[model samples]
Target: MNNPIPPRAKKIPHTLEIHNHVRIDDYFWLNDRENPEVIDYLNQENAYYKAMTAHTESFQKDLFAEMKSRIKEDDSSVPYFYNGYYYITRFEAGKDYPIYARKKGSLEAAEELLFDCNEMAKGHSYFQMSGLSVSEDNQWISFGIDTVSRRQYVIQIKNLVTGEILPYKIENTTAGGTWSADGMYLFYCRKDDKTLRADTIYRHEIGTDPSQDVKVYYEKDDTFDVSVYKSKSKKYIMITSESTLTSEYQYVLASEPTAPFTVFQKRTRELEYSVSHYGNHFYIVTNKDGATNFKLMKTEEGKTEKEYWVDVLPHREEVLLEGIDIFKDFLVVSERSEGLNKIRIMRWDGSVDYYLPFTSETYMAYTTTNLDFDTTILRYAYQSLTTPASVIDFDMITQERIVLKEQEVLGGKFDKNNYIEERIWATARDGVQVPISLVYHKNCKKDGTNPLLQYAYGSYGVNIEPYFSTTRLSLLDRGFIYAIAHIRGGEDLGRKWYEDGKMLKKMNTFTDFIDCSRFLIEEKYTSPVHLYAEGGSAGGLLMGAVINMNPELYYGVIAQVPFVDVVTTMLDDTIPLTTGEYDEWGNPNEKEYYDYMLAYSPYDNVKAQNYPNLYISTGLHDSQVQYWEPAKWLAKLRDLKTDTNFLFLDTNMDAGHGGASGRFEALKEVAKEFAFLFDLEKIKS
Candidate 1:
């Protein structure tokens, strides 16, 4: 086959001036999704991607099948008891969606089907169901569905007793609604039509028209987003308004569905806190009073004020209190120390306090699905780079635990012992130690010839935990090492780590990644010619920035729905998540932030250079990072890049930020990516 000609997007020079600074964007006209020309350009790019990768089609299919074979096609999640029923989400063989069912009182009881998502998703190209909420009475279930993959769901209630779907629908919701104690009313969040931000909270009465749903609260601040949930204690219906650096909560007695909400505390700048209702008090995990690592505090239910809060767990400089789970007899806290997860179990009376035993230094362990507060059993999940995920239930008093289920890798070739997992530290340019968790086949060696795929997402304090991926085994089996770089701009090392990599110090994130790459090469783990980098969304931004700064250091890169046009996206407040993310990536309206962001913005920084082999994918309907960013990026790169290295753009026209919302369907996307890497290394299975 002849070399495919890449799509060259037409450049209609558009000038943008911000803070008295002038910038020229040639492909700005591609932003209009409604324009037929824009769609044509995207289709052309997709066609080019198909043509360029046509030779690898069989390899991609085999890779996808190889990865899919490891997955148990007919599988059910561990049934968890909630309310009066045992709920289970199971996937039938050959089905792309799950079947949600419940049994009354016991696991042996006859199952009652709540949602067969496969049946519901049949008509939609992109479908996702979120915010599944069962009423307190367990007689009704509420769910939100997004057929467009824009994260905007339409909530619908169903009568479990009668097996009838309600006629009313609440549109443009964040998905899922918190039900009143009587199960007569539902509280849900509504998004702004233009920005897609959840800015309003509404209360809907069952059997009533959704159009008449009462507006419970409206967040006037553009920087803040709102969400509603029933307290874990099931006593209060809570509404939380939060920004990147601040949070404020309000509550109404779940019994009083029509009552107005009372503020737990007013929003204070830089004061981040989350509330959970307990017996007579509200337990809070907060960064109050300069507690950068966050501390635990409790306030009387009657006195929901910051002044009334007393320390339950004092702030520890070394430990970051990530979250907490309250129970009738105990309090479970999720903490992170030295970039490792720790789950601490404590009795309410202080009779016992200990962390659950975790053997692996680079494993992830956290509390999960402990809805029944009356029980002594604490349910949690544990997984490592070499271990499959296991959901375990623990007896706090006896210190005994039982593994409910471990993810079954079904191809018969799987063995945890066959892989080696380890944590290594790399020294950054500023002399900081960045942790990297790695996993590879035991046969693989730490030689410069080994191919290493490095991944990281250093943004919004989102820590990418070291966890196992069945699909990743395909890479390991092909003599590749998978590593997770715990770089700054994430909470891996604590809030301070994130703070040091944001705002004026944001460049540390890019430099730290590049430094890690250089360190890996210098240490003989992998040479520049054998190293590959991958990141999605914000991490995609990391990939773009690193390639721009040190393109020669990587052989290839895969950026999925990357937020690369930083300055432009951050400057436009109307874009989804832009306004609320001011604290994450500073508000670019100001000259200082404008200058800092523009300096590293990948699309803005693309110049005449020999770039690495690139594979970029985006969703046309993506709400978070607009599809046009990558489209415009590829166009400019095609024009300016001096290298003959292959650059491919794949756009998922049917999906949004999350490509392909299916069990096995999503693996095809990963297969394409893996194929790109394998093809570059000339390794075909």
Candidate 2:
């Protein structure tokens, strides 16, 4: 590779004043997506990215091909029985989209095609199909389609028997719809035009014009977003409105679609709960009554108010009750404790209780589709860093387990025994222990000579599971260690873990990742020269903060769709996900929060100092973190940073928050990032 010139953004001074504090933004002009100048600057960055990495073009193609080769081009998912039909999703030999089909009773029955996304997406540059629901009579199917990739979907109906596309369509929706028992009406949530927030619930009659659909309910608060769905039992249609700190629900019988929704409970600040129905009562999982770790309660069907609630599973100090799945004669509770997930099973009569056994110390297991309430066999999914994802059906009665399907790694030399997975703890600055999950080839040593890649996303109480990835074989086979930092701000260790890393304590997330990185180097797993970091979205925020604070600790960093311009974006309520995020990141209108946000915001704090090599990515139509955020951040980084180390930006002009929609196409993006890291390490195939 040769020395190359980087793109420099023009400086236009823009002053922002709030609470008598003034800040200057030189690259603020880059935020206007409609401006021709902004588009030109982004294109120039893309060109520079290409020019700088032109030497590795062939290597990248090889990387892409290697990664794609692991995938089964024509593979089908395990069919699950739902509503008297067994549904399956499979990809064809040469298609980028999936074909959703179903069989009436058994696999021997004639297959019925519900949707072929490849046919529907023919003319669109960017496409996504979701929210597929079949009517009760099984004669009609309603689904949502998005062409622009901004997440705003249009609901379309089709007659399965006649194989004809209907004229009924609903626009600006959440890409989901629930059908009534009679299949005469569809209930869906509509998004606000400007904010793109799901704010209204509407009922659309099957053969009627969508313009005449009745508005069933509306959520007026900008802080709360709404969604509508039918319960698993198919008995009730529920409309729920939730915010970061609170939630409320309204329900109506599925038999009477036109009935007014009845409030389950009035909304209260700091109160959160979700309801599930089984038999004659409603089960509630909630944080009400100061249950920080959450608890389960029950109330009679007709008397579902706070006063009538009775404790079912009382709150435990160290255990976090994440969710509950109810069946006719049993209950499966998902709980987290000691930084690991556990599934608890109990009989309906409360006569017996036990937990499913798992052998792996660091792995992820979660409940899968169990639509029927009559089955004794519970279906779930499990995976580890060294194991491919597998679907298991466990019988609660006999404790027998069956492996329904394990993801096929097509080029078939893959073996679980060739790798090792371990869990280690890293002590934070405040003496808190954070868990780190790592995996490496059996041939790889714990010597400081090897390169390692660390990843984390410690925000929004989202726990980063050490799930298996076939694409990661490219790194492990080349002597690279892959690790996941289970830092704070995530619910890995319980709800308290998340509480300590958000709001004013958000800095803990950044420091936690850095501490884990240092721990790895100290343990002789890898040294600073060979240590690489990768994070996306909120985790991308982690990457930005760590790079600003300890640039010398990493050899290179990859931040995808980073939310770097935090203060500026949070202050603007017009953007999607901003207003509703006030609780997660405090409302900047307050003086205390405004000052605190400014101190850590990556864009506001980027200084004139030496920085690590960076490869950043974003999607032009991203609805979560706008592409301009990364674009402007890169512009400023190129202008102010003193280091001449490689800095590149790649923007997908046609995609949204999720890079590419196609299964094989998304692997290309991963190949590009891996190629960047490999090039920095001078590793060639």
Candidate 3:
């Protein structure tokens, strides 16, 4: 340990021939998780990382404490009325997890605890719960629990009145369950064990053994995953099967649990739509008929076919129809235009409709829990880079909006007025305008000497909204400019924005991010020597790409659970998310896509060049982007790169894609990241 040890990965060369092209992968042997050599190498990397950052260990703890102090440990969420109960999630002081409880009728009633995650998570290192579905009669509750951090869960029923756990437990589920109206049966989606894909829907009768559960529907397509949920209207149990590009749905009457589900629409390539049950028809948001930005359509209950569909909100060339929350008398639609999200509320009778106005130039407003369909009140949450998240209820009848609660920043020193959030557009090489959302301390100067951390996730149409984060205060207070690059791959601008950033045009996403960085540098926000970059998962792909393309442009980079070895990962259908992402990253089996992906694929494109100081992180049990991708990428970079810049890997042996499950424990990783950046910047404080 005293000899300045660095893990020199043993290369066992493996040749891969695809489309008549021979590629040599020297670190292919690292993918074997069971091999002791692999574990030894990873542990050595961890040891080296710890030794390298030992000087910042004290700083890391202080950063963690500073971040934790900003969060109110005993805070409770705003309760929302649902099914004759007011559901609330609150945390207890000194605890990591929350207590999910509800009141029978009013908030003042005696609290009935549904699940105490602190108690259930005591013995496990990783734990998560989902699908907390209460029965129609409120006598039974079904929930999905995952203890292994692999996204696979077991569905268990509980008797609320007697406070007893039921004997029936459905295993290998997707952590969701839909309870029928009569509470006689529960429907859940089952995952394929090997792929961890939710591919089948099953029905389990109350009081029956799980072994007796019936397989109601099977999604044989490897590229599609299935999910089951009861409609907000509570009249139908809907089952949806979807991939990156297409979606199909089937539904059954909630009162008739044994009845077969009828297909709402047949599946078609590149056609994506979602359904919501309403009075006598199903409201759908679809991208069919070349509606690139998508539009709203409605169909009769029995004649639920594409041909019979009629437009409710006609396709707009500019506005992207994101989603809709249906109510008895009003429909709240979430739409995006010019890279900003807005909410439009329309009355059922088509007499009144108007957009909800926001005061911030860059803010995120989305629908929260609106379980009651008959009410005039609409619940939504809003937040900006400078503003704490606020839970709001809007009255559709009177157009009055009430802020129920604004998140309390535990430390009294935090003031929204002391910060400024703004939006700017950067021009890409192709002349496409890329939007940038940034926030900084009001006292901070727009100087090129300031350190800037830019983040982006441009894949699978997942738009990275400019949301508030309490943990980010550490960086802002330290004079760091935090910016989000709304690059092309995401649906930030419109559906066309995503379409131009994927498949053959995928390079747009990478170059757009680089362009944004250059623009910031030119604008005096930060210079290349003071710039740092970060991204996770697919966004991590952006991090790897930018560093490879312009290594001298960044002072440091942090990639968390990165999907770096794209060409290799996509070539293997055995990977959990590979098959389902064919439409996103494109299938490498095709020669056209193979050449296009390899041109920018991070691992394959690692050449002998200088790279910025890097801190890469991965979870050993990550199912989404296998840990081997980043491990292989790191080994290759360390061997080929000519620079002596710092390169470190931190692997969580007991975690998965989401990292540590505990609230406080996850902050340690963030602290380590901040400490790494701070040390590189010579910021000892």
Q: Which candidate tops lDDT?
A: 1
* Backbone clashes (count) for model 3: 0
* RMSD of each predicted structure: 0.8, 1.0, 1.1
TM-score of 2: 0.99
TM-score of each model, paired residue for residue: 0.99, 0.99, 0.99
Task: Determine which window of 10 residues in candidate 3 has minimal summed lDDT.
Answer: 1-10
lDDT of 1 by residue, 517-632 (tens): 89889988899999999999999999999998999999999999999999989888889989998899888888889999999999999999999999999999999899998888
Model 1 Cα shift for residue 54 (angstroms): 0.7
For residues 1-685, write the lDDT of model 3, one tens digit per residue: 5547678998889999999999999999999889999999999999999999998999999999999999999989999887799999999998999899999899999999989999999889899988888888998898889887888889899999899999767898987788899888999998888888889999999898888999999999999999999888889999999998899999999999899999999998889999998888999999989999999999988999999999999999999999999888898999998888899999878999899988788999999998888899999999999999999999988989899999989778899998999999999988878999999999878779999999999998889999999999999999898999999899999999999999899999999999999999999999988999999999999999888899889999999999999999999988897799888888999999999999999999999999999999999999898889999999999999998899999999989999999799999999999999999889998
Residue pairs with backbone atoms closer than 3 Å in model 2 (clashes): none
For model 3, the superposed segments whose C-alpha errors exceed 4 Å read 1-3
Candidate 2 lDDT, tens digit per residue, 354-409? 99998997999999998889989999999999899999999989999999999888
Full-model lDDT for every candidate: 0.93, 0.92, 0.92
Model 1 off-target regions past 4 Å? none
Task: Give the count of colliding residue pairs in each prediction.
Answer: 0, 0, 0
lDDT of 3 at 351: 98
